[model samples]
Target: MSVSKKKFNLVVLDMAGTTVADGGLVEQAFSAAAWQMGADPESMIGYVRATMGESKISVFRHLFGGDEGLAQTANAAFEAAYGERVAAGLIVPIPGAREAIERLRGEGRSVVLSTGFARVTQDAILAALGWEGLADFTLCPADAGGRGRPYPDMVLAAFLRSGAADGVQEIAVVGDTSYDMLSGARAGAGVVAGVLTGAHDKAQLVEHGASHVLGSVAELDGLLGELERSS
Candidate 1:
């Protein structure tokens, strides 16, 4: 299926869940970090879930604000824990993830893998999936200059890097969280697609500003088709 409409030339996708199969690893990492930092169970869980697609440090700031030392400590611990978990080769590309990306690229659409992870972790994920060079651009918060998801830094970075600055009207942002949808909307991306293969449900995604809700990244072609026809 064609994953584009009249002018969609870029598809910015999230790392975990959208491109990579998460399998609850992100939640587990957050829980471990929260516990290690002596954060309150209820509040930590709430904040982590609430900010599912933002940077890990961003989530830490939300959960353990006012205490930079503690938040930083917890952040390091979370990265370490997540790194270990992922290094064990537990992570894989979501089913159809490779196909979706390949198909999109084959059609000459620029594909960027944008994530909440640090650069190191993002590289690790790409390596684990044997997709080290698959994406035309692989980016994270650090690469964005400032801020992360729920903000447009990452998506805008994609726009600039992919040479879509003037063609922002042809950009699409696809991820599994409200943060991704909100970010895309903020970036003025013509297509903001939320997939249900990760942390969010359809209702949650729609509530957050997703113009298209997909079953998973595998259905990206369908999403592009629907949005195009609706246009």
Candidate 2:
């Protein structure tokens, strides 16, 4: 692939399943909310998984059945349940993620996080991982300006925040979901690297146009170095 044009000084990462396994937290929270509303737990989990990468309101509506009032109530219940469990220690960064971030920063790349979760939740994950100030910038769904992943809004927002808007050619979007891959492609990012550390598999990532797929974030150090050298 176009290695020369794919060299990037900036790398944007996705939080949640990519950086941390918050899917468990999400499922737990949704189940509790659904139970409170007398809904089936299994059904709620299916609903939540389908609505991933969307807004909180959308997720609640999809999970607990879509009346605005029910959605609002469900959202509050889910968040409360999630917050309590998060406080009790459920979220943890993926293996070797910290080392990968440190290595990238040490190599002079500007790193940023672009997430579907709220800023508060993102902060909690970072804190849980003890990864304070690890990234140059962070972009949450709220900061995404009405567009979420599978769209390019959040990725582009992170790029702008990292001072890479004018140099989009030198940015790579590394994520673990097809939403991340499609988002990067739509944003015109030169390279989009998908990892198997999150929800989707290699075939899914490829189907969504991921430029490369690796086993995990830990493999990033070598692959990224190779990309730079080839560039």
Candidate 3:
């Protein structure tokens, strides 16, 4: 199932739901922040979801209405709770994530991880997955001027860092959100793949410019074949 009509030189992947299951940790952290602030815990999910692909501080600003003091407060609480949660070692790589990354690397394709997570959090996940040195490049939102998803900064940063800038036409952006798809499209990447493993539904992803949507990363292997052939 070769999806690429021409093999891509590089593939940029989103970290949270695409490379690892940090969604729970994120939700938990937000919940704690809401609780500390005496806000509705569930309501915070909607705010945080909107910040899915942005920098931590930017997300905090978005969540707390740009009040620097409140953002600082919420951020501290969120980080504290999230750090404790992660220390319990509950997060894990999504199914087929490791295999897919290994497969892509084995094929000599450069693999870059572009994510909205904080650099510290991203580094922790990379270490936990034993992928710190495996990935060709790992880019955090901070490098992209603290902008979040729907902006191409993080993806572009990874592209530049991976040396894919030379072959930007041969890069794909894969993630579980419309933000990722839109970012990829804006970046002029070869393909924008949306997965259903996160909070977004298929309709939402497609509505936002996903050229292809899969049920999960487990289905990506075959989809890539089709994508390659079609490319």
Candidate of highest TM-score: 1
Q: Candidate 2 vs. truth: CA RMSD?
A: 3.7
Over 1-231, each residue of candidate 2 has an lDDT whose tens digit, in order, gives 112233577788887667676657777777887898788888556646644555566666555456889987876787778777777778877888878888887777778877766677667667776777988777877797856777888877777676643467677888887778888888888778998977778998888879999888777778878977976
Higher-ranked by TM-score: 1 or 2: 1
How much is the lDDT of residue 176 in candidate 2? 82
Q: Which ranges in model 2 have alpha carbons more than 4 Å from their true place?
A: 1-6, 62-66
Q: Highest lDDT, which number?
A: 1
Candidate number that wins on TM-score, 1 or 3: 1
* CA deviation > 4 Å runs, candidate 1: 1-6, 40-42, 225-231
Candidate 3 residue 190 Cα shift, in angstroms, is: 1.3
Q: Per-residue alpha-carbon lDDT of model 3 for 1-231, expressed as tens digits? A: 123334676788887777778656888778887899887887668767765655667777877788999987887787777767777787888888888888777766778887776777777777777887777878877777777678888777776676643566678788987788889888888778888888677897888788888777666556666766776
- Per-residue lDDT of model 1, residues 34-139, tens digit only: 7887765666787788788898887777677667777778888888878888899889888999998888787678899988987878887787778977988888
Of the pair 1 and 2, which is ahead by lDDT? 1
TM-score of structure candidate 1? 0.92
Runs with alpha carbons beyond 4 Å of true place in candidate 3:
1-6
